[model samples]
Target chain A: MTEHVEAKSATLADELLGVVQAVEGVSAVYPAQPLWQSVAGAAVAAVTGEQLPLISLTEQDGTLAIKARIGVGSPLPAPKVAREAAAAIRRHLGNVPAVVEVLVAKIEA
Target chain B: MKTPGDALECGHSLAELSAYLDTGEIADPAHLDSCPECQAGLASLRRLSELGNELLTADVAEAGSGGDDWMQTILDNLRLELRPGRSIPLRAEDPQDTLWETEGSVSALIRSVADSFPGTAAGKCRLLGDITEPGAGITVDVEIAVVYGHAMEERAAALRNELAKMLQVQTELDIQAINITVTDVLELPAPAMTPNTEDQP
Candidate 1:
């Protein structure tokens, strides 16, 4: 006989966002807020009094893909920081076959 | 019969319309008002721009304020290197030891001054002209975003004066001009609402 177990997926993206945010050299995480989500979030917030998270996650070809917008501190090479951030995200999501992309939105001094 | 990225029957492309929206200096500004193709293209681009703004607002809200833990962690990891531009010599206590302030520090000073104002955030900043030479003529160019509801001209003038004072007090560079550009105007978040007492009644 085979048994099946189900795990809730509600908080997975949020957990990933927290981990990525903790990575060093990242100034600010780019919130990839979609237009529709903003509208929906406003409506929901009016009722539920909750805000949305900025990080976005998508499932593609059975693998999780994460996209983040980040600010790089001035005097640090943006490309290098972005690469390190992506690596940190992958390290946190062990064995998940995740793809991560970090975009340097602004260079903050 | 028109798809995005496709040129209109009049031979003008959506790309032209997008550029026109940004620069407002199209080749035929008068024709734009009368051409149906151009009108349609402009309408589509405007809708897209609105959607983009909405997305940015949502993202910024989600990111939280500058003091949030997420931003803190990123800052902690950064270990940013000091931007020491041209050296500006300072009076040294010891005859042998040399002291100087960095050009990067001046830029930082300008940014801080702008940021101190309510409803304003500083963006890219530049120190133009020669700074390596002592008493060199310098031009300060600062880009800033003002929150909605603030008077732009007043804010710019105040920031300019404040920056001039701070720079003079802090450094010995000859500042010839302070140019302020209002790059963006951000919307304030909607206020939270309380339960309506009238509705309960």
Candidate 2:
């Protein structure tokens, strides 16, 4: 029974390692702390009153990519943050527009 | 402060009523029962709050899931730049020329290591210590989100090992530590056309 459990654990670890290694620019992955959960949750709640934005940075074809959801208030304003976010991406990719495109995925209710 | 019209007509102030509505404190609470104006104002504010809640629900529904097409579209549009915050000296091929890599590049490398895991995603990342100076000790801290149901401890351990290996190979920052904080665990709905997509189609 112990051997079976150890083997299953090892398999899970190996699968996770493979996934982490597959991301283009990632050097590591780890469990989030409880404190971060509260702080980020509160911050996100204050901003949108909805779930927090899921933030991620990845490299696609040697260029960096950032993924997130931008919450807008009703009577939705022009997406100014969308533009600013794009600019931030541009700056990260060494001012390369070809390599960067800001994607806004709206979370479903 | 008291407004003139309500005070003159009914011996009651709209300002006082408004304050009372907000704070639930009134000098003459019973008088509000006879005041049609105060009742009307309170009703309006209550309705507005209800509408606000409805709008909030709608907007969140529109934000869609991380794996949803809305996110996919946004991701497609956002070409993020590498955060090379500092210039780390690299061994120059020419004796006089400086060979260097940016702190952004190293951070990008770290992110790549984290993203390699399925059901795991990376977030705001930071580098500790003065990355501007050569051979400065730097600690890498990263925020990440995992899909609900993924084994976090297992994933985290894998990421740590992978990053240690890659960072050791890539940069000369005196490595102190790598902190991974799971800031969120997202509940991604099953793949389908989100309501917005269906509307457009």
Candidate 3:
């Protein structure tokens, strides 16, 4: 007898952001911009408006791409931190074909 | 089949206009003003830039403040190596023990000073000159973004004075100059208003 389980319903972008934040050497994970925010921002701009979700995810050709802008802690090498963050992202999204790009936006001392 | 970098019918490419925007040194400034194609391209680029800024603002807002847990987690992972640039020697109580402050610290101090001012955000900051040598003449070059409607000249002057005073009090280096460049003018967000609840009868 096989037990049926319900698959979770949510965008992987948020999940990816949380996973990236958990990785060591990352000072801050940029928040992912939501679609609603974009629509609202457009409406706001029509009147008067102003925005970082540091992480952005896009899916193209069945391949997921993740872009994360992170703040590195004072004294940590940014390149190394970025590399580790990318690797952690891949690990977290196991079996899902993904391209992860990490950018060190700020260094916090 | 038009290539990606193909020139527009007016003979000017998007790349050229983008470069013109940055350096303001185009091959034919007069022609650019006269050309309809270039004008259209410039307008499109400007719109894209505006949208980009809005997206960035939204993303940052969602990320929460610097002290938030998301930021804290990233900070924890980053074991940043101290950038001890040219160190200035300090007068130590014990002659045998050497003391000095890093150039990185000075830059951080400059950033903090600029950040303390209202409606201003600090960007890339640099200390130009030989900082390792005691009493070395240094120039503080800071790039900042200001909110719209603020007096740019006054803000720059105030920042310079504040930085100079802080440097004088905090460091022993000779500050030759403080150069503040206003790189971007940011739009202030609309103030949040609480909904009126007294009308419910």
Question: In order, what lDDT does every prediction score?
Answer: 0.57, 0.45, 0.56
Ten residues in sequence with the least summed lDDT for candidate 3 chain A = A1-10
lDDT: worst 10-residue window of model 1 chain B? B73-82
DockQ metric, candidate 2:
0.01
Candidate 3 residues B6-121, lDDT tens each? Answer: 55544566667778887888876855533323443464345434434553665533322322332232122111111224555434332222334445445655665675676565
* Sort order, lDDT high to low: 1, 3, 2
DockQ of each: 0.01, 0.01, 0.01
lDDT of 1 by residue, A18-83 (tens): 776776666565455532336786588557855455566666687776766555554454445556
Stretches off by above 4 angstroms in model 3 are A1-109, B1-82, B188-201
Please provide, for model 2 over A34-86, each residue's C-alpha lDDT reduced to its tens digit, 9 standing for 90 to 100.
Answer: 11335775576557755321333334474434332222112221123234443
- In terms of docking quality, model 3 is incorrect
Residue B175 lDDT in candidate 3: 90
lDDT of 1 by residue, B1-201 (tens): 545325544456666777899998787675563332344346434543553465366554332232233222222211111132455554433232233444544554565567667656566677888776777799988877665678999999999998887767556678999999986665555566888999895
Q: Which window of 10 residues has the lowest lDDT sum in candidate 3 chain B?
A: B73-82
